[model samples]
Target: MTRIAVRHLGPPRLTAGLDGAARLDWDAHRRVHPEPRPLTAARLVALAEEGRLHGRGGAAFPFARKARAVLDAARRRGRPVVVVNGTEGEPGSAKDKVLLCRAPHLVLDGATLAATALGATEIVLGVTDETAAESMERALAERGLDGRARVVRLPERFITGESGALIRGINGRRPVPPGRKVRASTKGVGGMPTLLSNAETYAQLAVLAGLGPRRYGSVGTPGEPGTVLLTVTGSARFPAVVETPAGAPLGHLLDLCGTRAGEGVLVGGYHGAWIPGDAAVGTRLSREGLAAVGGTLGAGIVMPLGRGTCPLGECARVVRYLAAESAGQCGPCRLGLPDLAGALAALAEGRDAAAACETVRRSARMAERRGACAHPDGTARFVLSALEVFAADAARHVDGGGCGRPVLGVLPADTDARLRLEVDWSRCDGHGLCADVLRGLVRMDEYGYPVIPGEPVPARLEDDARRAVARCPGLALRLVPRAQRGS
Candidate 1:
């Protein structure tokens, strides 16, 4: 691996006022926090641009740019809606959930500001857990923000947390991506332009609103200004959600968590990449800093793998879980993920080791850029990086019987692959529209019962798949994400 040297700085902006205070209610919140600025769209955009604030969501998109887009669209299309996405779907991530629970008022303040900027009278908050939802609701009532804001309990599944999926759920449809490109800034819930961002982003926005541009930009690095919330877990003594400035030293944070040099670290999350344990030390925690070390600040997740566990076995288990979590609307994600997972499992168990390893590599390649979303591609990256970072251990699995270690299963895969695609036998008149619309993903069986590929439809072809679904005359074909469906 190449050595990229960079200086590290300490982060103190976001966590500055907390002082270890956990869960601040309305009264506690107002005590320390200052009054937010009287926000207009232009003022918010200027402040965001000056602070160089980025979304805390996995994508790390420019918050100012996104806000501008939504505000612009609203100018032409009347008042838009604002959505605070508190649904933290990434298993390794807890920052959003924590912020929603502990500092619900801060998040709501940001949402209220954003709603005002967008000329939106309604603000909807999407939360996956009961605690977050309740906290938000109480904050709304206490602030006399009722009628203007609503709390929605979103599905706890992984993929359902996508912005598009959240919009679908808000529209009273199944919480899954529409299998096509739909910009939330242009057409979101209730078919109106919407401004949606993650919980941490809203909190940061609240802070920025209170601090203004200069004061907010005082702490973090030049390129990535402001603080970020990170969920540091796995093998660490102090496994908790932390707030730090953007450019804090990765080594310093690891030391605080009692992580050492040899223990492997998984930066980002399950969908993130793995790097050599020592490679992370001294590196900065900003997006550019992590990228310099061949990692991303994805959803602000950093997990350490202790030397005791078998890396290959651990990788295999995660691959399997990711396979099972597929939305089943994308063929490449559905089929390729399971195939890669099977290959990884075989490699871990020392069964057909060389062949399985090759299959895993091949399947990962085929799955890349083939899904409706980045799920398959991200899963592939995680597994492939594991194989590279733990090459010696991988060799042991192939050349020797196995690593002779236990699978710790330290990574969190809370949900099962209970979600599947089901065809209604009674509704099918066998018109074959399903097969005709989605070419490679769906086929016609002998009886003309649209033979659904037991795999996930690739994301690239999701629009066609959705078209096939919409054109189905019998209404027989339906995409089921889990065995037990929710409204």
Candidate 2:
């Protein structure tokens, strides 16, 4: 595991000091913010606009408009609800988690402020990470806010953090995106207008409320004022959670994290585009700044694909994980995503590379705008961007047998890459029997090949697992006990 490196390029408001993890107790937290001041609904919305605050989540949606919408809904409907989205589900992103763990009170202050202004009696904080949940619980306890706020543990799947999905999970429904669009602001938890925002976004709000826009907006560019937290990982010397003012040079961040020269960087998260090494130079960090360079400041996940790693293969690994983690409710999840994953896998393996590349592009196109949520569109962006950015490698695989470079597994995925259910890809013939006999333990991918999750077989299923292994005609399957796995 890489050691986490936390650094701040400017004055550290969010992170208390250079040595990160500002675990401030209630009294200490009071020293930081002096407690939240009362702000009317319209005043809060106006402050968000003046602060130029956008969601720290991938979308970077304007905070003022969303708050106003929730306020309007409350006027027409009933008193609103507030949900602090602490479910940092993106495997590549950790900024929200870092804030939840280190500055729990900061996030709570923001949430409490929003809840009070919106006249929301309930402030449900949905957190996927147990540690983050624990941190919020501790912060709430310290503040003696047991009655005002509550914490709900959410599933850690890739799509479970979507607003509707999180609301569903809170509402005791399965934590998957709805089959169609359901605006949370209009009808969220218990059919009340909900003011839901990412945890970091709320923290930004708290900061804005405290600083009153002018001092808060002093550091960053005029358009995108205030500092932003970025999770810079992959191929960098050390994984970093950096707090830098907006409009900082993208190259500077890459260099700050020790990103190697001439390596492609995946801007945003898996749902973001890839920028070439040359293109990354002098790129800025704001929404427009990244857009000028064909990039998006998605969830603030930035990773440089290291030299000697097969970028396409690494992307395939993540896409495969993404496909398997789908809600499986819409056409994209049921068909398009699986096909995209399989096509990318074929491209990575050099099997029908020309046809596979075409299929990959076509699958991405087909998946867009055909889903209940932005999952499909975001996934399509990830796939099409890879094709465009890694065209040279695709061309190499198309003409030649394969790219000589190996997939370094640099990109993170939800699946644990443990030594458990093992398959000799060289010998596997898509038997389809493993899935039928083992049932949930082993499932077949779109290509009829087994898509074994990285989990140890349960003690009760050991015999069934062995039977499936024995039944494999090509002798391609086996289960390794945890003892032998060096766990």
TM-score top scorer = 2
Off by over 4 Å in 2: 1-3, 18-22, 416-487
> Cα deviation of 387 in candidate 2 (Å)?
1.4
**Predictions: Cα RMSD each:** 9.0, 4.2
What lDDT would each prediction earn against the true structure?
A: 0.78, 0.82
Q: TM-scores, in order shown?
A: 0.83, 0.88
Worst 10 residues of 1 by lDDT: 1-10
Which ten-residue region of model 2 has the weakest summed lDDT? 453-462
Q: Tens digits of per-residue lDDT for model 1 on 239-270?
A: 76777777888777777776764557888888
TM-score of 1: 0.83
